[model samples]
Structures are given as C-alpha cells and as structure tokens.
Target: MIEVGSLTRRYGTTVAVDGLSFDVRPGTVTGILGTDGSGKSTTTRLILGLDGPDAGHVRINSRPIWRALLAAVRGRGAVRSPLLPPRSQRPTPSGALAAGGGMDPSRVGEVLGTVGIAGVARRRAGAFSLGMAQQLGIAGVLLRDPGVLLLDEPVNGLDPEGVRWISNLMRSPVARAP
Candidate 1:
C-alpha cells in the first residue's frame, strides 16, 4: 500500500504539493488528476522518492519510502510517469529495455508484446510516434513486473484504441495485485 501523509513541497516561494495525504490500497487503481500545472507529477515524483518532500512522509507497504528507494530504483515498484524521459533515444525497443541493467533480457520481448508493440521491437524507439513511445515507456515500467504502479498522464498521447488498451491493462487483475 502507498500511504502519503501531510506531504508538502515548495519551489522557492511557490507551493507545489501541500499537505497531501492519501492511501492506495492493494487491488485498486488510484489516479491523481489535475490541470497541466497542478502538482500531480510532483506528488508522483515524491512518492517514488525521485524528489524529496519538504515536509511529511511517504510510505510504501508500511516502510518509509526512503528505505525502499533502492528497490524502487532497481524496478521492484517501477513508475511510468510521463514526466520521465525514456532511458535513451538511440536503442531499439528491445535494446533499450535489455540495457536497463536488471531482469531477464528474454522478458523484453514479452513486455513489448504485452504493450502491443512487438512488431516494432527492433525499431529505434527514437523514431516512434508519441503513442508508440508511450507504449515503449510502459513496457519499460513492466520490465520487472512492478508491485506498485504510478502512472501520470499515461494515455496523454495515445489513440482511442491505445487508450482503451491501457484502460483495460490497468483494470486487469495482474495490475491490481498487491
């Protein structure tokens, strides 16, 4: 579970996330929605331990997120936030994921297939359209079969069909497992 309590962040004089608190229990899909400049991305980054909160705490599975930062960075609870760029621009979909350091290289094909981009597995991800790039990012997120998923604007550049596919993937039992 993700338990965020009294979380806050500031950029100079501007407040980004202010005392935000919430729990995302197992077997559920929680969304943080807001306008473009809202703190949604900031909150996700804080939860992922990619950014430090000025005040308050973020706990994942009863452990403060700092304790889990190593695992998180290693891909146990991978995040798919759009704000993060792909690992690289030059490698093919397969090459990029294989180079991510951990996990079986064989699983690269499986994730690509799962995201419906197996046909482009050998193509340079740099040349992909926005929607396909989104798929590539998702495939990277799934490389280690993450236990916690934090997707920000996951469907932003997707087509109608791609959006539906992502919606279904989020609702699937596999995605909801603790």
Candidate 2:
C-alpha cells in the first residue's frame, strides 16, 4: 500500500502541491487526474522519493519510500540510468551490458519481448518510435514488479493499438501483483 499524508511541495513562492493526501491500495487503480501543471507529476515524484516533500509523510508498505530508496542505494549503489549506451559502446568487454548488480542484461531482452518489441532489442531507444519508447518505458517499470504504478501522461504519443494495449496491460491482475 502507498499512503500520503498532508504532503506539500513548494518551489520558492509557488506552491506545487498543497497538503495533498491520498492512498493507493493494493489491487486497485488510482488515477491522478489534473491538467499539465496541476502537481500530478510532483506528487508522483514525491511518492517515488525522487523529490522531497516540504511537509507531510509518504509510506509504502508501512515504510517510508525515501528511507527505503536510501537504504537500497546504500547497499547497491544508485539505480543505473535506462538511457545508457548499449553493450557495444561501453568500456567493459561486456559492452553495453549492465555492470555488477544493475539491471540484468537478459531481462532487457525479456522485457522487450514482453512488450512485443523483442525484434528491436538491439536498437537504441533514442532511435525508437514514440510507441516503441513507451513500450520500453513500461518494460523498465515492469522490471521492478512494483505493486503500485504511477504513470505520468502514460498514453502520450502512443498509436491507437499501443494505447489499447497499455490500457489492457494496466487493467490486468498480473500488473497489480508484486
């Protein structure tokens, strides 16, 4: 479960999120609706521990996500950027493959396959179409098997088929499970 209590975020004099509170329970889809500048992305970032809240608390599975992320980082370095160059360009002999305990190189192929883009596994994301990039993004999220998903403009740039596929994918029970 993800819980937010009296969350607030401010940028100088501007208030992005004000005392926002909500809960995203397991086995449920809680959509955050708002205009482009309505703090939706800010709230998601706060919940994911990507940004600090000026006030309030956020808890995931009864533990603070920031604390958890910090701990994870302390133990295994920070998560690697998904935009890193492919194995062929890396300095290591392994090439573009993730070094150490980062994301599994084999899983990259698996996720691409899961998202129905296995044929383009070797292609750089920068060169992919918008829909293909979106699929890769979804595949990246699936890598962690998160119980709660927070998508920002998830349907952006997707074709009709791609949009439908994402809608069905998010509604599936398999997506709600940890």
Candidate 3:
C-alpha cells in the first residue's frame, strides 16, 4: 500500500505538485492521470523517495518510503544506478556467470526470452529501440518481483502487441494481489 497525504513540491517559483493526497491500496491498480507537467511524474518520484516533499508525507506498506530508502542506504550504501555495458561487451556481468558456476549462459537468455527480447539480448541496451528499451525496463522491474509497481508512461513507446502483453501481465493475479 502506498499513501500520499497533502503532498506538495516546488521548483523555485513553480509549484509542480500542490496539496495532493491519495491512497494506492493493495490488490489493485491505481492510475495517476494528468497532463504533462501536472505533477504526475513528480508525485511518482515523491512516492519512490527520489524527491523530498515540502509538505505532507507518503507511506508504503505503512512505512514511509523516504525513511525506508534512507535506512536501506545506511545499511547497504546508496543504491547505485545499474550501468549498461558497452556495445562490444557482454550484457550480463562476469560476476553473474561466476554466480551461476558455468551453467549454460542461457539463464540470462531465458529471462530475455521471457520478456520477448531474446533475439536481441546480446545487443547493447543503449542501442535498443525505444520499444525494446521499454521491454527491458519492464524486465528489470519484473526481476525484483515487487509487490508495488510505479510506472511513468509505461506504454509510451510500446507497440500494440507489447502493450497488450504488459496489460495482461499487470492484470495477472499475482500483480493484482500484490
């Protein structure tokens, strides 16, 4: 569950979000709808603890995400952004291979296949098409098996087929229950 109460954000003289409040309950998909610059992304950022609120508070599963992220950073160092390998290099880390202990390199291949991008799994993500990038992002999110998903324009660059796949995936019982 994610809850936002009287959340507000400002950028200099501009107020991006103004006194917003909402609850994203468990076991359901909640859509945050607004035009561009209407605080949609800002709200998501606040909920994810990527930004501080000038007022009000947000909570995830009854615990504040800001506090949780701070605690996580304190315990494990700040979470570093995942880096995509160079075009000439392998996408999966050598450490991943070491962790698998020389199992067929097909484990990563299988995950890519599951996301419908096995054919281009070896390709650099930097060079992938926008739709492919969206698939990869979805795959990354799926890797965590998160109970709560916060997607900003998730269908923005997807094709009809890809959009359907994502819709179906989000509507799956596990996602709904989570």
Candidate 4:
C-alpha cells in the first residue's frame, strides 16, 4: 500500500537518499535498514510527507498521501518518529491521538491499553519515561487504523517487556491485514 519510486533527497551538498525505490504492500511488514546517516529517517519523512523528495514520489493506497488526506476524513495513514516530544511538553495521550480527529476516547483508551499505558492515559505524555513515551507514540499510530503504517525505530526505547508487547501486537492477525 506504500510505494516509493525513484526517490532522491539531498541537503545542500550532501546526498542523503539516492534514487530509492521500494514498495510496502498491504498486510506486510517492511523495514528500511542502514547505519547512521544512511537516509532511513529521510526516507520515512518523505513517505509521510514531512519532507519533500528532491526527485521521486511516494504514494499510499494508489494516491499521494496528501491527496489521500484530503479525500478521507480519518485513518488515511500514520507514522511515528524517533525524535519524540519532551515528556513535559507533550500532550496527554488521548489528546495527542485525537488532535486531528478520527478517534474517540474509547479508541484512544484501547490503543493506550494495548501499549500498556492506559493507566496513565490522562497524564501528560511528556512525563512518561522514554520507554513509555515510545509506547504512547505507537499507540498514536495504532489509533489511526491506517491503510499504511510507517514506523522509524519504533522499538528503540522499549524495555524487554515493552518490546515483546510491540512484537506481539504487530504480529496479531488483525494488525497484519490492511
């Protein structure tokens, strides 16, 4: 459901991504791997429309994500980044998930519960530990029930238990389907 064709990006004189192309089909997991400064984050940003590709295109569900956003009122797609907001500066879990609409309190609660942070649903996300913050970010993505899910280092901050939770959640049959 996600497609990248001839993707390229550059910053000043540095080339970050070069003619990248790949497809993430519906109901499957795909990972982009590389060492630091290898353009993984840049690629993710391009796919999510957070950054423009110097030359290339990214599409979700056969339409550009921006177009999809305009066509659908909810659940077009979602992503979480590695640079999370500061705990004290972040919004409450529910508020963050519902900020752009498409989710209600119960859905937010369900996502928070799935990520093992429901007990602190009303707390400011900025107060959570790194692992908890990661969970909340994952929860925000799940709340979308998106046609596409683009995650960049989603488990980077999790403890073993939290890592297992994300593993099981993503492997669930429901999560596997588009």
TM-score of each: 0.84, 0.74, 0.74, 0.79
Q: Rate the local accuracy (lDDT) of all candidates.
A: 0.81, 0.67, 0.66, 0.76
Q: For residues 1-178, write the lDDT of model 1, one tens digit per residue.
A: 7899999999999999999999998789988888887899899889888899999999877789999677555534543543234547467878878887465767888888888999998987667778888888788877766778778788978999999998998998757766
TM-score of 2: 0.74
lDDT of 3 at 176: 64
Q: Please say which candidate is ahead in lDDT: 1 or 3.
A: 1
Each candidate's clash count: 0, 3, 0, 3
Give the number of the best model, judged by lDDT: 1
Residues 20-123 of candidate 4: C-alpha lDDT, one tens digit per residue: 99998877877789999999989988887789888988887789767855654354445454335664567787887777466888888887887788999898
Clashing pairs in 1: none
lDDT of 2: 0.67
lDDT, candidate 4, equals 0.76
How would you encode candidate 2's per-residue C-alpha lDDT over 82-149 as one tens digit per residue? 33345455232122333422777787666556666778666555566667666766666666665566
Indicate the residue-level lDDT of 113 in model 4. Answer: 85
* Colliding residue pairs in candidate 2: 86-96, 87-95, 87-96
Better of 2 and 4 by lDDT: 4
Model 3 lDDT per residue over 7-76, tens place: 9999999999999999987778777888988998888788778889999998866777766665433221
